[model samples]
Target chain A: MLSIRNLKVTVAGKQVLNGLNLDVKAGEVHAIMGPNGSGKSTLAQVLAGRDGYEVTAGTVTYQDRDLLALAPEERAREGVFLAFQYPVEIPGVNNVYLLKAGLNAIRKHRGEAEVDAFEFLTLVREKMQLMQMNESFLNRAVNEGFSGGEKKRNEILQMAILEPTLALLDETDSGLDIDALRVVSNGVNSLRRADRAIVMVTHYQRLLDYIQPDHVHVLTGGRIVMSGDKSLALELEKRGYDWVKEDSAAA
Target chain B: MSLSAINQPAAALDHYRALFASRNVPDDALGKLRRASLERFLAGGFPTQRDEAWKYTSLRRVESRRFAPADAMPIGADESQWIADAGHRLVLVNGRYMPTLSTPAPQPPGVTILTLAQWASHSPTQVADFLARHDHAAPHATPPTANGAFEHLNGAFSDDGVVIDIAPNVQFEQPIYLVHQWCMPASARSAGSHMANPRIIVRAGAHSECSIITHWVGDETAESLTNAWLTFDLGVGARVSHLNLQEEPSRSFHIETTRLQLATNAHFGKHDFALGSALGRSGTLVTLGGPGANVSLNGLFAPTGTQHLDTYVHIDHAAAHTTSQQDFRGIAAGRGRGIFNGKVVVQPGAQKIDARQSNRNLLLSNTAEIDSRPELEIYAHDVKCSHGATTGQLDPVSLFYLRSRGLGESEARALLIRAFAQSMLSTVQVGAVREWLEARVQRRFDLSAGEHS
Candidate 1:
């Protein structure tokens, strides 16, 4: 469903992603693990088409189409979603209003009818229940004065509402407590479908315990150096990322 | 002085003298007051950039124009822009009260509503006495150099306006809606341009409660100047809410000065919206004269195209245990320029005073500019005063976040712009006024964003 080959990227005149390659098929869950400054977040941001990042040389193909050529909104309309590590705090835009606008935009792009207000509220209430979010959150500004755990849950709630085909989670579990982690895991686990793909980037292996991944890849020096099954996350947690760097160097 | 500098003021003074002479009325008390005001305006020709209060705004464009007094010719004006279901309506066309267009519904007992012209014709001496008393009650809060040239001009030329007097202990249920509209005069094509000066004086007695909405509008084809003066005197425990909406034609110029006086336990709230006019300036001065007096000022100014909008606000805490708050927002697009200067003063004996001032601005284009200044003068040691100002463009991160949610670039920009303005729009308590303003503000930003992309 997604493919990246020798992705060379630079930010602010400095090369961040030297050479990276990754591929994921439909219905598969992949986890990318790396230490600090290992370019794990860069890959996710590059895939989501953020500005200020120059793709020096590489190709990214999504569903057999060049993803880099499309604008961020066009990519989003085509079922590409990125759960930001730090959700922006918009002071005046209500949370529900943004969700409705986004959902309608995607629906219009797909030649579908816009969601009615009543139906939209019903769907949102159901999703909020899954995320264990309070109803008062619907009326508040988007992430304005929200707690760390509440912001993460709001992001997951947005993900569930949008229902994207390709979901990229960047450090979604970094600041969540254990209970919030469980709720967020349940929300994500419920979204697992046969025709969808999920890619999670994390620095710890604790998240993999709740929502198990089908494949685990160790990213070091801006490239994936090791690929194994779910057991690889447990092994990497026990040992460290240095061994993977050494193994790739010897190879 | 230079050769033309001396001759310029002389020429301008003669022009006004001729205009005043043309009135040809009896030399009564009201006439004398008008002559005195005209003399004051002539003494201070027009404020220059040297004046601290007029530092960022220039009156050269207005000074160079020759605008005769607008004739009292009643013509059919488009009423589609008027707020629907707004309380008892009082319409003024070209500064003259239009009795045919205004609502004739009788006001409740203890509420007296009349035109300035009516009052002046009936009791000229009483009207003169009231004006003198009002002038003395609310002194100029600006610097010495910042003379009241336009206000004095209004006093000299104002022929008709609204005068509302609410008796003590009265509670006005419905707001008093006043509309000051301008239309193309029959001879405007031949004549260069015209000017209108309207005065609104509202006096609320002790323990009275009321709301006032003043709207200014003009025809697209009319290129005129409107100088308006409004004053509100609140007795002890009186409460008043005033909303001023200025949306003149693009070719028009607008200048307004509002002075407010609050007595013991009186509360005053004002919302000023300056959205149109080629060159617009609004000055508001609020004085808390007695203990437990409070005032809140909220304003939003959006200047698009070549429009230049300026708002100046001054609040004085003259008594003990008084409080004040000022929040203003400015949105400037195209080559427009916006200016906001807010000053707060706490007198020596005004202990336990709490004052806060905040001004935030957004520039939609590189050429758009906004100047914000917050000034504080404190003579009391036991007062808490805070002020802050920030001017910036739309947050790139916030824009990207919206775009990533499937909103087009222009849509994302429009949404963020509305978000910036939503805080001020939400403060309008009247439902019809709030919705109308919300639509107008949104449509404005949407068009600007469309032009950009």
Candidate 2:
């Protein structure tokens, strides 16, 4: 479902991702783990088509199409979603309005009719229950004055609503507490299907206990130095990332 | 820049003199007062950039045109733009009261509504006395420069407007909707240009409460000038809410001056929406006179194309325990230019005064410009006063966040702009007025976003 080859990316004249490669098939989850400034978030942002990230070399293909050629909205309409590490606090845009507009836009792009208002509301309410978000959040401004846990849950709620083909979760567990992490994990786990793929980037191996991944990769010096099964995540969490750097250097 | 430019002021003065002579006004006290005001206007002439208050705006376009007095010519006008179901409608065409168009609903007891023309005709001396009493500049306040010039001009040519009086302890349930519409005369093209000076006076007696919605609209093809003045005198513990919507044509010019005086424990709130005109200026001066007075001023100004809009707000806390808040937003697109100059003063010995002023601006195009200045002159030691001003374009992060949610680039931009404007729109308590403003603002920004993309 997704492929990246020699993806060298630079931001503000400094290289962040150099010679990175990854591949994933449908119905699978991948966990990318790294230390601070190891280009984990950079990879997620670059895949989301954010500005200021220049692709100096290589290609990214999604669903057999060159995804790097599409604009951010185009990428989103083509079933690509990025749950931002820091959900922006938009003070005047209502939370539910954003959800409806986004869902309708993607629907329109897919040549489908707009969602019915009553049906949309029912779907949102059911999803909101799963995420444990208050009903007042629907009318309030998007993430404005929201707590750290609420913001993360809100992002997961959006993911559940949009139901993208490929979901990128960047540091989604960074600021969440134990309860919120459980809720977010439950929301993510419920959406796992045979035709969907999710790539989660995190530093800790704690989230792996809730939503286990099929594969784990250690990113160091802007390259995927090691790849293995879920056991590698526990080993890295116990030992640290320096050993992987040394191992890759010796290789 | 040219020889004729130097003589422009003199020529403007001569034109006004000719106009004053052509009117053949009676030699009564009111006429004398008008003559004096005209003299004052001629002495001051048109304020230039040299004046501190007029630094960001220029009146050169207004000075270049020789405008004739507007005539009350009845023509077929489109009333579709007027707010429907608005209570007790009073329509004024070309600054003259149109009784035929106004609602004939009998006013409740203790509430009086009449036109300035009708009141003057019934008791000219009494009307002249009322103007004489309230027209003077407040003591210890900074004398108006450009605003003074326009006020004097309105005084000289003031013909008709609405006069509302609420007796003490009276609660006027329905709002008073005042509509100012313009229709071009058949001879307007041959007559060069026409101008209107309409005056609105409202006196809310002690313990009374009322809301007034004033709308200024005109024909899209009319190239007329509207110079209007509004005054509010709130008695002790009275509460008043004033909403002014300016929606003149792109080819017209509009200048409005509003003065508000609040007494002991009185509350005054004003919402100003400036969304039209080629060159428009709104000057508001609010004075908190007695103890425990409170005032809030909220405004939004959006200028597109080559339009220019300027807002000047001056607030004075003259008594103890008085509070004031001013929030203004400006959006400039295309080659438009906007200015916001707000000043707050805490008078000496006015202890326990609280005042805050905020002005934020947005520029959508490379050529668009916005100048925001928030000034505070605090004299009392036991006062909390603060002011802030910011001018910038839309936030790129917010833009990306919206677009990443599958919204188009233009759609994202328009949504963010509307969000920025929502803060000001939410302050309108009236449902109909708020909805109307929301629709207008959304349509405007949506079109601009389409044009830019």
Against the true structure, whose TM-score is highest? 2
Lowest summed lDDT across 10 adjacent residues in model 1 chain A is found at A239-248
lDDT for each residue of candidate 2 in B130-177, tens digit (9 for 90 to 100): 787667543444434538888889889898788999999999988899
TM-score of each: 0.97, 0.98
Interface RMSD of 2: 0.5
Instruction: Give the alpha carbon lDDT tens digit for every residue of B1-453 in model 1.
Output: 799866775676678778888988557888777777888788887888888888899887887777777774746877986888777889988888888888895789989889998888877777987888665324544332333888788878888898999999999988999999887656664577778999999999999999999999988877788999998999999999999999999989999988888999999999999998999999988889999999999999999999999999888888999999999999999999999999898888889999999999999988899999898999999999998999998898888888888889899999999999999999999998999999999999998876551
* Per-candidate iRMSD: 0.6, 0.5
Global CA lDDT computed for model 1: 0.89
lDDT of 2 at B186: 62
DockQ of 2: 0.87
Per-residue lDDT of model 2, residues A207-239, tens digit only? 999999999999988999999999999999888
DockQ category of candidate 2: high
